[model samples]
Structure formats: structure tokens, C-alpha cells
Target: MKTKRMNPFKPTAGGEPPLLIGRNRVIRDFEKGLDNGVGAPGRIMLITGARGTGKTVMLTVLGDKARERGWEVLEETASSGLCERLVSELRTKEGLMDKLTIRPSVSFAGASVSLGEAELSPKRMPETLRKAMAARLDILEKRSSGLLISIDEAQAASMEDMIAIATAIQHQIRERRNIAIIFAGLPQMVSDLYNDEVITFLRRARLNVLSDVSLDEVRNAFSQTFADSQMTISDSQISVAADVTKGYPYMIQLVGYYIWDAADIRDSWVVTDEDVKNGIDEAHYDLDNAVCIPELQGLSKTDREYLEAMSQSDGPSATAEVARRMGKSAQYAATYRKRLLDAYVIRETERGEVDFAVPFLREYLRKKS
Candidate 1:
């Protein structure tokens, strides 16, 4: 039978390719925790990575899985007034009774709220929010078995608000065995969480740090995605595409999108090496003009210096090394490291090595250096 053509190169709302790879183990671990009571001592999981590393997508997938297991899910973003918006969303007239489903108890609210006649700002009342969150989870436990709260872009949240949120989770939520919280953000999220006095308690929560996609997985993902669309491409072409992207999820989609479009124009069902090359060139040009340039404009002088130094280094440098290179003190270099992390400009590897979080950013920094 003839197959239908589907585009494999479009960016989904969750910022992930339709096919996700190298995450089965992580997903299973989370599922096990939720199924077995959030682990022996109880824990939350933090998934951190660089920008465009599929952190958001991982959260969404996990949220979906949690729902299938009958856990209540609450999702919030870390924009401006997230806390106030969450309280208002949860405290509606219908309240917790209306948000539960067989799938999972799910609720969503923003950081801003519109009162009957005015807009209210987000606040940092840790104690109050703690109580409220506990109450909501209690209701979910009665209806479903447990509750899972997922927060995206958590690093973007205000430091004070993060502390308040962390306080509530550590103090109020920790007392209950029926709730779990999952936070996903950039690598700097760890620093932000550590700033809170209650962070030691928070650290008891589990941590899941995402990494880059593997070359083999990237090839299979792209090949399968296109195959499902009734298109055939040689392995060599797929490898070239993967090489150009370095297995970055966002770049994978960008390259695939253009290649599929090119094939459609020529009425060809097969993608060739030449097609892949052209697609990559197009993606690089577009990214340079759009995303890369704008991000460069946002960097401060210190950010640029740290990025250049790290790009030239073999691995993550200690505070002393970074400071010595810049003729500054270790303490001063540490501050710049935090800033770079907060800005999603750099990330730490498992071996305590640090490097540019985004490959395109590294390329851009190399050019400037």
C-alpha cells in the first residue's frame, strides 16, 4: 500500500522531535518512583540541561506518563508572577474538585492574575503556599493515588519566588508521601535552588541531568520519522545531516524541515547527500541571522569573556583557573560562572567539566575569539 507523506522537520510545541531517544531508562526510573511511592525516602526529580536540549519535551513526556498512571499533574512556568497565578488557579470557586481526571489530577496557572477589578502580583508566602499545595495533593490522593507537579523553565523564575516555592516543597509537601514535584530547567537551576536556606532538604529530591543526543539515535530518529512519511533516504545522507546538527534536537528538526521541503519541490521520494548538504547550509544561515545573533546581543562583557575562555579550554575550569585567565580573583570568576549558567550560556558535564551549553553559541564564541 502507498504511504502518506508526513513532515518530520517541524518543531513541536514542546520543542522536541516527534521521536525521542536515549531517554527510556530515565523515563522508566521516574515511572518506577511514582509507582513505588516517590522512592524509599521520597524524592523529587530535577532535569537540567542547556537551552534547546529537550528539557521541556522530557517534562511533557513524563507528565503524560504520570497521567496514564492516575497521578494528578500540575504544570506551571517560571515567568513573572507564577506563584500568585498558581494560587489563584488552584483557589478558583470550583477548586481541586474540578481538576482531577482518571488520567491524572492536572491543573495549570500562570504567574499573573486578574482580580475582579485589578491584577494581583506574585508573592512569596512560602508557608501559605505550602499548606495550600498540601491540601490540593491530599484531595488528589483520595481521588487518584498520588500527585505530580511539573515546572518548566524554573531558572527563569525570580530567586525570591524560587526560594518560596522550594520552601513550600521541602517543608509542607515533604511531610506527605502522596506527592512528587518535577522541575526542569537550565544547568544554573542548581545554583538557584542552593541559594535557599531550605535547599539541603530540597536536595533530597532526585536529579536527572539531560545530555546531547547520540549520533546513532539521531540517525535512527530522523530516518524513521521520514520513513513513516513514505520517504526514503540513504544512510550516508542521514549521517551527514546528523553530523551537521551534532545531534542537537532543535537543529535536527530545522535540517529535516528544509530537506523535506526541498524533496517535495522536486517531486522526489528519496533524499540525497546533496539535499542534506543544502539543507544544512540553509539551516546554518537562518540560525546565524535569527537565533545566534540575537543571543549574542544579550550577552554582557563578562559572559563573553567566560564563554571565550571556556571554548578555548579542554574542559570546565576551576574558579581559580578562570579567574587567573581573566586577571581576577577566584570569587569574582565564580560570580561570572553563575551568571553564565543562569543565562544558559554554559553547562557542567558529569565529570565537573564546563563548556558552552549550545553548540551554535560555542561556534559563535569561537568566531568572536
Candidate 2:
């Protein structure tokens, strides 16, 4: 039997999986918008999720889909200086207009001597950033190719740059110019962005909040991915793997990756239940260190304390209960609650109830506390 060449699973955050388990509707809507061209609702999209919820991967999918439809895709993070970077990209494309050159030559004794070269005059780019973007769009418009701008880590982008991009896109939309902008970020940051007065227009953009995937989708992905990778496992084993992931996109990949490696270690062509059992511990450790720890480290002392209190609950905890355990006033606890909710560290299941959104986070916190 031929050994499988390598592990097919990609467990790292932001890495594309062999099979995207969920998000079918998102992909379909985006494609429909691209087909409709300007003024389509899908053209302007905001993807919000927690850190490991595949926001970046979704942006990648959006860009890939646009490119497949013969559109120009420009991807960038919404970091500081986004406006300047976009302006620079537009200027570069503007320079491409003067690519042709002509050399004046004189023939003497059957030999041609070049005197000087006259090049195509460069087009003047607009001084303003918005106008410069418009000028670039005009060029693409002539060719019947639309532009798709995708921004990842959008929460980090400065308000000024966000406004510039929003205004430029608004101008293009008003003109019916073919352009679209997609943004992905953490839920709280995205909410903050939408609440900003300068980019109020983005309030109308289509919002996609990525949540836990369905178990059926996860199971199907595991079966198909493993079969393709030349590994076989029982349906029960697949179920175990899926349940282990708790429907988190990143955890699904992590469990699959480690399980595959476990099979490899045993020199077995087929994956067994024992391999999966061993892999779970390893996957859990890696997930905590890679995702959970760093997330906690970024929080304030009070926020961490709030989470530690919440961890005592088996399921969703009441805000009042958590406050009582922390020995703080209800208002004081409310502040940290809101902070954690905004940060996507916890989610509200119903009125007065909150729970850890990150799978297995409660267990990790319990051990730490």
C-alpha cells in the first residue's frame, strides 16, 4: 500500500481547511452579488466573529470567488495607514498606463543610432485619495472588470482610514461603478465600527456573524477529508471527533490534524478509535496554549476575574450570580460583563444569562483558577 503523502488537515488559525464545513449561505450570497454587479446587497459585507472563528478564512474565500469570476481582488488588513496603502496601490496601477516607450533613431551607413527615447506621458493621478481610487476604478471599468476590496482585521483600522474607504466606495456606488468592499473583524470591533458616525454608510452593509457550525456539517467534512487522505475510520469514530470539536471551526481542524498524525505514528493505514482518543488530549493542550491563553492574557484583571467566576457554572451563568461570587456590585460586574461580551470572550444565551463562547474554555479556566 502507498503511504499517504502528508497530512491534509490545516489546524492553524487563518489556514484554509481542505473542506469548509459550514458557510454555504455566505458563499452563495457573495456569488450572487458579484453576478448582480454594482448596488447588490452582497457587494458590501461585514463578517464578525471571535478570534478562531474563521473570519480570515471567509475573507479568503470571498476573494477567491471574486477572482474566479474575472474580477480584480485587493486584500489588506485594516491596520494603521490603510488609507495611505490603498492610495499607493491605486497610484501604482495608475503608473501602468504609461508602460509603452518609443525610441527615435537615425540610420547612418546601414547602422541605426538611437538619439533619444520618448515615452508615453504618465497620466495624472488625482491629488485626493478618494479621487485617486476613482481614477483607478475608471481604468478597470473600461475593461469590464470589477474591483473587490477585502479588509481583514478591520477592527484595528483607524477611523479616518475607514471613513476614506467608505466614502470612496460610496462614490463608486453612486456612479454605478463596479466595486465591492468586504470587511472581517472581531464582533465587538465590528460593532464599534458600525457605530462610528463617519462610516455610518457601512451600517447597511450585509452582516454575517459566524457562530458554531452544525455537527452534521462537521461530521461530513471529517468523513470526506479522511477518505480523500486515504485514511478510514468508523462512523462512530467520526462522531467522536466531531463532538470533540464542539462545532468550532479551528478545533475541528486541530482535532483532525492531530488524529491524522496519530494514525501516522502507529504506521496504520486506517485510523482507529485509540488514535482519536490519544489525539484529543494533544489537540486540547495545543488549543489552550495557542488560543485560550493568549486570549485571556489580553484581558484586564477584572475581565479575567469575571471569566473565572463564570467558569464555576456548568452552563450559562447569570450576571447577578457571577457578580455575587466576585464580591462586587452589580454595576461593577456589569462593566466587565459588557467588556467580555464585546470582546467575544462570552456570549449571552438569554436575558441575564452569559456563557463562554469558546468551546472548552470553561474547563480550561477552571483548571487555571
Candidate 3:
């Protein structure tokens, strides 16, 4: 029997993907805050998840919704030098802040304003940036009903900047009642944000952590995708594919892509269990060859050993255990932990347990070891 061809299921750049299942609750929460007024203390939203868990997608959706509601939105990526760029951008746009009734205390002229002029000349650039931001927000309070700033990959932002931004938003801007900030990034983002001794921004902001999709949701989403293409697949087939992927968004799409293409090659009208099995195998191979191989090429021997040890374990190891296994002291293991986390090799759960954030990563590590 020939199989029916299916549609592609990869992420659509610059557009919403079909079968974007789940995340309704998060959308609603953001909408509720906007409706009630974002200027209320403790109204900001922070979305964190592993890479490819759709943090970017959620942020884009929220930005679209906010724009539809007549709110001014500024989207930027978190980076070491983002604060300076932001100040430069703000200064270049004449009366940009004026539209929202925000007036800059100091203006950028021929070159970007020095972090000093804005009363931000602290030891940390982020601190300086925060003061400058507060000054501008003070002006915005007069013009706009509210302002929303959306930042992606916010964990990359400097500790000083994170603290500065959080402090300004929580203490300085919250009083004015006209601004909201949303930060989205990998799971470590919250830890980085909280590391600032001066501010408890993570505590004050609402957390919206994206998790793996449920089996039922995954089945429905897959079935819906096929149905949208005027094709059909068996429930058992969908369930099997979901199990293989554990409902990770990227894996789901990867497997779906193979299944659809396989059906096209067979000229079949319906997907079967066998096709799902083949697709799962193909997806695993593709991930190993495309993602894992390239990342492994750059790792040092110690890094590889650390990853192997982590993969064999179920959760975060005790500092002492990891140190003993790696033949290093607890202090040395802690350093490796930070390096791995920074490279996205591992993640810490809410309860402080560490693990391979992506299931596929464990498989890759096992094969390598």
C-alpha cells in the first residue's frame, strides 16, 4: 500500500508554525497581566526552557499580541554590549521616547552617549545602563499607557546589566506604572538573573517555564498536521512517534519531516506504524550527524569526560561525587559545571538538580563514551 504524503513540520522562520500545540496557558497569563495593567509591581514575565523548546516562538507570539493591543514593543537580544547598543538606538531615534512620553536625561549625539553622562558610570556597564534606562522610563510614564520590552537569550546578558535592568524595573520604573519587561532564554537564565546580589528580579517576575509536551498533546498535534494536509495516520503510529521524541518540539518536527518525506517516496495515502519507526531512526541519525557531531568536534578531553559522566547519571550529582569521579576537587568540578552549563551541555532543574536538558544529548554522550 502506498502512503500519503505529509506536510513539512520544521520551524517557520519569521512566521508561526502549523500545529504549534500547547502554551495556551502562558499566552493567557501574559494577556491577563496586560489587561489588568503591567505597571503593577511584580508583573513582568520570564520564560525559560532548554534550547529548541520554543522559547523564541512564545516570545514572538507574546510580542504580536502586545502590539495588537496598542502597546509599544521593543525586541532585542541579550548580549554583553546590548546596553550600549540600546542607548545608541534610543538616542538616534528622534522623539522615540517622546511617543511614549519618555524624555532622555541625556541625548546621544554624533556618537553614542558615554555610560557616564546618564548617571550610569558605575563599575559595571549594566549598572550604568540601568540608571540610564530608569531615566528614560521616567520620561515614558507621561506619554504611553504602557511599554513592553522583550529580550531573547537574556542569560547572555552581563550580571551587572541584568541586575541594573531588574532593579530599575522593580524599584524605579514600577512606581511610575507605565512599563513592563519580558525576558526569555534558556533555563539557566533565571539563575543568572538571580545571581545579582543587589536585586531579586527573578523572585519579583512571573516565571513561565516551557516544558515538554504531553503524549496526548503530541498525538493531537501530529494528527492535526496530517489532517491539515488532507491525509491521515493511525493513532498507534502517532503514539509511537510521540514516545520516540518524548514530545520535544524539535524532535517532533524532525520525525514528522522524515515521515512526510517517506510517504511521498512511497506514494502512500496513509502513514503506518512501520513508517513511524523508520522516521524515528532517521531522525535520530540526523540529529547525531547534524547537531551532536559538530558540537563534539570542539570539546576538550576533560569536557568530553564530564559530559560522559553526566549522561550516565540520572540527575545532578553531588559536588563531591562529581569531583571524585572526575579526579578533581569539588571546587574544580564546580568550574566545569559552569562551563558545561554555559555551553548548553547541561541544565539545572527548579529544585537544583542538574541533568542533560535535552534527552537526545544523553544518547549522544553514551554513544561517544
Error of 2 at 151 (Å): 0.7
- TM-score head-to-head 2 vs 3, winner: 2
Please tell me which predicted candidate would have the highest TM-score against the true structure: 2
Candidate 2 residue spans exceeding 4 A from truth: 96-127
Q: After superposition, how far is residue 5 of candidate 1 from its true place, in Å?
A: 2.9
**Model 2 over residues 284-360: C-alpha lDDT tens digits?**
99999988998788799899899999999999999999999999999999999998887788989999999987877
Worst 10 residues of 1 by lDDT: 97-106
Writing each residue's lDDT as its tens digit, candidate 1 over 165-276 gives 7777766544755777788887778767866675666677667777778988988888888888877888888888888888777677788888876776667888876777
Clashing pairs in 1: 72-105, 73-105, 81-111, 82-111, 316-354
Candidate 3 accuracy as TM-score = 0.76
Using Cα atoms with residue i matched to residue i, what is each candidate's TM-score against the true structure? 0.77, 0.88, 0.76
Off by over 4 Å in 3: 1-8, 12-15, 40-42, 92-145, 264-269, 272-278, 289-298, 312-344, 347-354
TM-score of 2: 0.88
Candidate 3 local lDDT, 1-369, one digit each (tens): 544443658743324557667888888888888887745432488998776678888778888887887766778899865665665554434244321134244455755544344443335555545544555565555555456778898978887667656665666454655666889987778876676667665577789888788878888888888778765688888878878878777777788878866676677767776777788888899877765676667777887777776777766655456667788877777877778778776776544356777768888877766
Error of 3 at 201 (Å): 4.2
Model 2 lDDT on a 0 to 1 scale: 0.83
